[model samples]
Target: MSLLDIDGVSVDLGRAPLTRVLDEVSLRLRAGEVVGVVGESGSGKTTLARSILRSVPVAAGSLRIDGRDVRGLRGGTLRAWRREGAVQYVFQDPLRSLDPGVRVVDSIAEGLRIARVPSEERTRRIAAALRDVGLDPELAGRLPGHLSGGQRQRAAIARALVMQPRLLLLDEPVSALDAASRDRIIRTLIALRDAHRERLGMLVISHDIGSLAALSDRLVVLYRGRIVEDGPTRQVVARPRHPYTRLLIASVPVIGVAGADRTERAALRAAIDA
Candidate 1:
């Protein structure tokens, strides 16, 4: 069975006349699998990640984790689930996400504190998490402001890892890093996935198709809140079936054609109109 299952889910944000940002979105993530969600800006990638964490209410369809219905969880049960760290999220901007005043160790231990983990165990986990992300344990005493951009991002990832999450939702996790830092982060993720040995699942949301092609086992392409294509990363990158998917690949110089053809864009627009 899939570790994470999202079946025909939809999300409507705002009050009164709700705006549909996600429509009939169905995807699944298996243990030890990294699935990448790729799309242009405003394509509802972040919303989908938020919905999985139950930060946004699902308007339709079912979301299940480990065969338990997520929509049915309520009150203490929901809070407990969240607090237990079954799922963890790594935001795009670690500098903003990590508290400037808090030491790295404390920030990484926040969730454990909430869950009432013993202080001694928390320290062990925090150090282990930092190592897992290739951060030095000695740096844990420093504040977020003191760390470099790459270190800060890895610290944020360590914060998530400290939770020992079964499913990881990384929203544009490497977008803000430099080329070298980005490559290191990607390598760290690969190592972590291998270390987990099928006990963990990951959903990576990014706009960079090239990076996704390298990191993901499967790729799910979203266009206007809908999944236009889903397949093996190599297959999708090598042979994109949808116009929007083609455009995404073409836009990435390192992955496909240097630029998307103007005529193809025009044809896509016409197709959408028809």
Candidate 2:
């Protein structure tokens, strides 16, 4: 069975005539598989992620995690669902995700405390998670404000990993970082997935096609709140079938291009094609 299944899922913002942010989106992720959800801003990528976590209400269809219906859960059941660590989310901004007043170690340890993990085991797991993400254990006591952007992202990842989740939802998790820092974080994520094997599944949402191509096994392109293309990562990157997908892939800046010339030209061509 798939680890995560989203079927005909839709979200309406209840505006005039109800603005549908997501329209009958269906996706499935198997254990150990990494799926990339790629699209421009307002294409509902984050909305999809939020819906799965039950942070956003679904207007239609079903969302299931590990064979259980997410919509059926409530109160203690919902808490239990979270404690089971079936799904985890890493937001775009690590600084925003982490509490300004809390120490990094405590932030990483919060999940364990809520799950009632033993104190000793929690400490060991927290340290290991931080180390796995390429952060020094010594920095655990420092506040989020003290760490570099890369370190903060690593810490956010550590917070998710310490929960031992089966599925992870990454919503533009590296988009806010510098190129060097983004590269490091991407490598760390790939390494973590490799180390976990079939025990983990990931849904990576990003506008950066190059990064998505590097890390995803498959790619799904969302346009105007609907999936327009879905296929293997290599195939989608090399030969995009949908016009929007093609345009997005083409818009990626080539190395050595001065200023906005190449990208602007590509954008113009894409607009013409669209």
Give the candidate number with the greatest lDDT: 1
lDDT of every predicted structure (CA atoms): 0.90, 0.86
- lDDT (tens digit, per residue) of candidate 1 on 17-88: 999999999998999999999998999999999999999999999999988898878899999889889899
lDDT of 2 by residue, 1-274 (tens): 9889899999998657989999999999988889999998999999999899988789899999888899778899888887877688998988766897899989988888988999999988997898789898878789999999889989998999998899999989788999999899889988988988779999999998878988899999998899999999988877777767766776675411224466665774576456
Candidate 2 regions exceeding 4 Å error are: 254-274
Instruction: Compute the lDDT of residue 208 as modeled in candidate 2.
Output: 83
lDDT value for model 1: 0.90
TM-score of each: 0.95, 0.92
Per-residue lDDT of 73 in model 2: 83
| lDDT (Cα, 0-100) at 88 in candidate 2 | 87
Name the regions of candidate 1 deviating beyond 4 angstroms.
259-274
Considering only N, C-alpha and C atoms within 3 Å, which residue pairs clash in candidate 2? Answer: none
